[model samples]
Target: MNMTPAPKAVVVGAGPVGCLSAIALAKLGWDVVVYERRPDIRADSLQASSCEIPARIPRPRSINLTLSARGIAAVQSIDSTLVERLLYNAVPLQGRMVHHLKGNPTPQQYDRQGHCLYSIERGLVNLIILETAAAVKNISIKFSHKAVGVDFKNNVLRLCNSVTGQEFDENFDLCIGADGSNSIIRHFLMRATQMEYSQHYLSHEYVEIRLQAGKNSSGDTFLLDSDHLHVWPRGNFTVVAMPNKDKTFTCALFAPREMFDNLQYPDALIPFFQAHFPDLLSLLGEKRLLSAFQNNPRSQLITVKANLYHKGSVLVIGDGAHSFVPFFGQGLNCALEDVRILSALLCEEKGGCDPSAIHRVFKHYSESRHEDLIAIGDLAMDSHLKMRRSVATWSYTIRAYIDNLLYALSESLFVVKLSQTIFGPESTGWIPLYSMVSFRPDISYSAAKKKAEHQKRLVDSVGISLAILGLGYILHAFINLNKLL
Candidate 1:
């Protein structure tokens, strides 16, 4: 009797997204191996490499994030325990605390009722996902192994271990690239098939700075608000802070590249920080500020767009497929959801699918996800403008007011329901891109936009009705007073 072999999956990159992808696939009974270009992230300690940060300098580790309900729901779907563990260490950001031009009466909150995002250290989050993947018996990890290139047509991969100049060829039935923006796997797959791709780097450059904690007499921590994301928005640039598990904060100065490049030395950095972000200088201190400016790397923000993310046995997800600017704070969240969607699709196919099935599913994913990814990417870019300028605009304020009203009405007023009920969560699941991409399983990005559009229209209709009713009431009161006269 002859026995068939289990289909194998090769995942490139051992980052949070990659690790999660491997674990998700393993859960579906696929033989999986994950490869990382760098040494083990679990063993390495990097300081505020990602955008998330804490409140106070020489501070302990903290991360800046907007862990919304969408992201939370996605993580919970796969591993509720993991979500619990994350929440146990997570800091809820009820809303963004927008610091107005100095001496403003009050700060702005993102949501009136206090529904905020979250702040979670990138390092710790990656560690948890990696650890979870390690626990899965069917998943294997190869650290310090970099993919030099790949032959997508042959389903073969060439990898080099950094420590040793050892090279090897591995054949797999499928390859999933989570290798980040500059994905070698993606480049290889594109060569074998017709793939459309575009990448754009924004004019912005981000510099991460430390804000040391102030100790109380009891050796406790003393600082400003610890429960909110603090943003001091300047016209052209901004300084933002996110709280850490510890008693400190990580602050970042995001400015145009030209501005950063013009200031070449540590001393120049001090003056720049003082001029643009006065309070941060006092918090970070001159010495530490200089060190961070001169020593630490300046992060560049970019948007990567790919037409098709898969071909034959090779596929791409996460940063490899769609990496947007950090303004939206959706990169990690979206990447996590990508795995959930991919896993659900592959699981639906079951064991009977051929090698091309995975590739075909990915093709569908790219097409369906393209609009949402583009929309979010565009939204992220637009948000940078909104954060800096539109927060005070009349149009923005009216939009915000209408948005809140609709959300409240949807939850409160049951008499008139939204159109979503007709489509339902499954049929219209494609419509709530946020719900589908970030919350539900197998729904594409484009579908979510359609749902959101429909929801927006409903909100608009209600708003118009309210406006007209107010006008009628005012006119009626005037006529009654005239009759009395």
Candidate 2:
């Protein structure tokens, strides 16, 4: 009897998505190799540099990740034990605590079923995923190795050592470009195939502010609800915060570059904070707030979308394939889902280095992923308006209540009745757009967007019917349809 050889795979970039891809491939009996240009993300980028104010701040990567249903499901799909390890020290956010300028904060639960999101540092998640990938038997990680070029037809990557500057070539049965937003693999694919691509930088810039956890008068340690995500959404400009295990809140302010430039003077920041975030100002303290605004790095947000994700045996995943603004907090989740989807698709193929079979796999992956990726990109970019303006409106509040009520009555209690009445005979059940996009991994992004539009129509028609017939007029029927979407 002859033993079959394992399929070979090379994953570029050792970020969370790349690591997860390597692990998933290895699990399918693939001999996987992961290449990273950096020494070690933990030491090189994930950890703080001499310039950063906080010792724990990740240098190159600033924004923390909000892990929702899609990300959780993907991790669970990869390894059950891995999910436990990742979520052990994470902060669970049950809902958004919306802070208004002149009134009390409003708390909105994510779902009645106690659904929540986990907030973890970008560095920590990347580190954990890399470590988990390293533990896999057939996966190997190559640090300080940069992929400079690629040969799509032959499935080869031209590599250069970061420290030594020596160049070499390596070919694999399958090569995945998990190299982030500025992926070399995507570049090579664009040259080989006319891969549609677009990237834009928003005028908005963001600055991270560290809010130290407090101590009450009794000297007992206290915090601003570690279980809730804090937000001061002020229309075009906003401030958002997520809790850390160390009891600190990682707060970020998003404003136009002009605003940031105007407030460059030390004196301007406090006054701006007082006017825009007076309630939060008291908690942030004068000293820390001043220092954070002055010293913390301000960064720009970019959004990218590409078509034709694969050509030949090469494929791009994560930010390399589709990059979104952080507004909806789906960038990382979608990327992780990419790995899960790719892995599952690969598992369908027979364990052999069949070139034609692999090409077909790549073709299927790109065609299937296109619409879903485009849907997410649009949603993530537009969600900023919904978060900043609509959340505080009476219309938004009423819509939330109605959505939940309809979901319960239709989905939980009367799925058949709903299908006949409001949703046509084809309707499955009511799902709030938020629930569909963030909490339902089974539903693709494109499907969720389509269903959301249909739901909107039904809500409007019903509300109008009640009013015209002199039944109770639903004045609180949602109005910001464009922004809310």
Candidate 3:
């Protein structure tokens, strides 16, 4: 009789990507273990909320993210039940409603047919993922297991438990690090192999504010457009809101580090909000603003680029490989995709027990994942300018209109494709490669962008035709009016 071997894989970090990574690997028949330095996020919820905790708490102005096709698909790929649960609690953002500094309202739908992104609480989402992981029978999740160092030469992970401060070492058949931006795993891998890395800190700082959803004259729950991501674009800074499952919204203010420093005390804070984020004051309240402003820590944004993602027996994914600015809201989405792709690749290479084989897989992951990571990172940074300034400009509105018109002309096939990729029952291959990459199961990020470009051209052709037709109609109407005059 022939019996299958129990393959073992270990993951660092119990964050969303890390949990999802363990889940995906477990589903592939690997005995998975996830090590997190902190306690169960739910158990540590209040304890985690220190004003000085830069590593744990959210930065005020940073966006939580709009989990679109790619992100949802990745999560669903691991467990459909988990996907349903996520959607049940999520706040759907059907479009971006850009509020100009001048107070003009314009909306842009993410999908051609008006499909939207979902707004979820980062902390809550992390909790759900972590809890789901804990329930997996084949997976072992050890909280408070901080990875202090890694030794690739002997395939060893050195960790210190937060509660005990006792040091220990664990060996895995294969280890993956989803340990995030300041990953110790990546640092260790660099020493064993030739790895190039660059870290850049942006000039921006962000602060979080809250908005209430009170009954208006009609007694509706939402104060702003509930199905849209609302933004107040102020040059060099911005205020954006994402709705919660509850009637409230989470608003964040992103500004320059210098500007944030100027807001030293609670008194200066109120007047500043009144001048810049005037609409938010009534909801945030003078007292809450004063307290939150005085209490909350300023969050600094940074981007890290790791050239080689792994060495020897270990591999790294998510923010450990590339950390980006939050403007595009793709940070989480992209991280989730990393797990999907890496899992599929490892499966393709067959269940691994060999260290050299694992090293080769990491090489492929780094090389293949690079283009998509770089492209998205660049797009995210570029979006900061758009979110803070251009969202209010005439050019921005016109460009959006053109983009939408093109999307509409495509018969919204890509939109349908996106929905299918994100919400459909089929596996990754059924969708367009872009849909697969962005929302499907296994396509790479670079391939997704390539497919998106093809679809964009088709949409653009239709838009140009509509523009020309509209112009022709105007010309004819002018000639007829002149003759009548």
Number of the top-ranking candidate, with lDDT as the measure: 2
Over 395-472, each residue of candidate 3 has an lDDT whose tens digit, in order, gives: 766766655554345432333332133222323212232234433334455555566566557657977899999999
| RMSD (Å) per prediction | 6.0, 7.6, 6.3
lDDT of 1 by residue, 98-191 (tens): 6665554234545544555677777667766777788788999999998987876788989998899899988898788999889888888678
Question: What TM value does model 2 have?
Answer: 0.89
Better of 1 and 3 by TM-score: 3
Runs in model 3 with CA error above 4 Å?
Answer: 1-5, 43-63, 215-220, 353-356, 411-444, 447-485
List ranges where model 2 is wrong by over 4 Å.
1-4, 43-61, 216-222, 351-353, 413-427, 471-485
Runs of candidate 1 exceeding 4 Å displacement: 1-4, 44-63, 104-115, 265-268, 351-353, 392-395, 412-485
C-alpha-based local distance difference test score of model 2: 0.81
Using all chains and alpha carbons, the TM-scores for the candidates as numbered come to 0.82, 0.89, 0.82
lDDT of each: 0.70, 0.81, 0.74
